[model samples]
Target: MARATLIGFSAVAMWALLALLTDASGSMPPFELSAICFAIGTCVGLAARIFSPPPPVRERIPPQVWLIGIAGLFGYHFFYFTALRNAPAVEASLIAYLWPLLIVLGSALMPGEKLAWNHVAGALLGLAGTVLIVTKGGGLAFDARYGFGYAMAGVCALLWSSYSLLSRRFPEVPTTVVTWFCAATSLLSLVCHLALEETVWPEGAVQWLAVLGLGLMPVGAAFYAWDIGVKRGNIQILGAASYAAPLLSTLVLIAAGFAEPSWRILAACVLITGGAVLAAKSMLFGRDAKASAGAGA
Candidate 1:
């Protein structure tokens, strides 16, 4: 479980590069870019399959698993892009990032899971840090005009959190199944691109390389790692730690000269790091700590 949770953190680390890579990929339409990157992501999974083939039982994965997998990947992205289009980026993103907190809260419903005080506190602290990062300590004034977009962002949060939780219920399902989900998402994204967006391909070698980088990291292997983590890892810790993505992303942007440094970013780093440590207190200490925590609860 610890190893799987660490693998999940790798996904968050890869996601930190998403903003930098997308910025470098030029002004391609969202769906078009999604299609292309996910196509490469599909190829990535295929290459892995060639190296280590999954068992025959994995081939007989249930239909509901496929449905949930595709819906989670494609549905979350589609709504997220739509929300960004319809609302202010800062507001939309802040709302969408509630998935981690939602996951922490929702985990109580999972079988044999305990909703501890530290878990909730850690999640809330992470959310506070995320808010600082997303809003840059500025006030949010949500206008009535963007209500639909705000609602879409809420849906994005629910979809992703539910997806992560639901994945836990199907521990028998292999992570390799994510490959098919990526393939289906790529195809669906292509269809959406054709219908709703003008064709605008990546321009130069740099842009092309950026696109490939996105596919190989954030969009590709990240999902695979996440699948394994959510199915068999310490989900509460994963939920709290997920907030580190935005902080890491902001730092990456600053390092790449795409964003300016701010005191808020520094503060967010402290809060997020502290929250992760607090959430993982049991794992860091020992099973005796966990027993004590459970007794207190």
Candidate 2:
């Protein structure tokens, strides 16, 4: 559990760089960037599969699961890169972080999971934080310029939450199936890029580094580590812990001179983290108390 927790945290740390990397990609269309990143990830996945021992043939993955996985892997990155292009990274990241809250809320739809009040409250608080960030602490004038981008970020959050929730329904499917998901999305992204976007190759070390960084971390290895954490560790802790990514990412962006620190970002951080903790507190801590009580009695 401890190892998985550490791995989960490491995955989050890798993810923390995603916003900055996406922005650093420089003028590459979202579709093109997504295609490139997933292409690299596909290669890594294939290589890993080739070296690893094969599992039982009986654990056949269903086509429906394949469809869902592809949709999720493709949909999330597509919206995410587009959001980064359309909106400020700080705002886009905070908004994108809403997935944890959504994940908690969406879990109610799962069989054997009831809708809890704290979860609802947590989601609402997170929503409030998103509003604060989008409104720029109520200072930004109403305009269409970045609204679509913000909306795309919202969609990114929704797609991810939906993916996470649905993933819980099929524990039989190995996480390695994400490799196939990557392959499908890579192909889809390439088709979209060729049809709709202007291709721009990375021209310098910094730009190429951004491309490589994203392909290796956020899109590739991070997913594998996260799968281990969620499947092997205490998920509530990992889920709540994930709220740190936006804060960490924002700080990195500021440190890189890509963004200026602001009260809005700080407020959003507080609200989102607080909300996630509140939502997951029962699963995270209440189980421990129950176990203690059982042992004492």
**Model 1, 1-297: lDDT tens per residue?**
777888888999999999999999999999999999999999989999889965865456888898899999999999999999999999999999999999999999999888888988998899999999998899998999999999999999999999999999999988888889999999999999999999998998999999999999999999999998888778999999999999999999999898998899989999999999988888778675565444334
Per-residue alpha-carbon lDDT of candidate 2 for residues 1-297, written as tens digits (9 for 90 to 100): 556656766888898898899888777877888888988887778888889888877577888888778878898888887888888776776678788777666666667666677767766666676666556676434346789889999999898777767776776777788887888888999998999788888878899899988988887877767766655544444555666666677778989998888988888788867877776566557765465334324
Go through the candidates in order and give each one's C-alpha lDDT: 0.92, 0.75
Predict model 2's lDDT versus the native.
0.75
How far residue 23's Cα lies from its native spot in candidate 1, in Å, is 0.1
RMSD of each: 3.3, 4.5
TM-score of 2: 0.78
Worst 10 residues of 1 by lDDT: 288-297
TM-scores, all models, native as reference: 0.95, 0.78
Please give the clash total of every predicted structure, in order.
0, 0
What local lDDT does model 1 show for residue 92?
96
Best by TM-score: 1
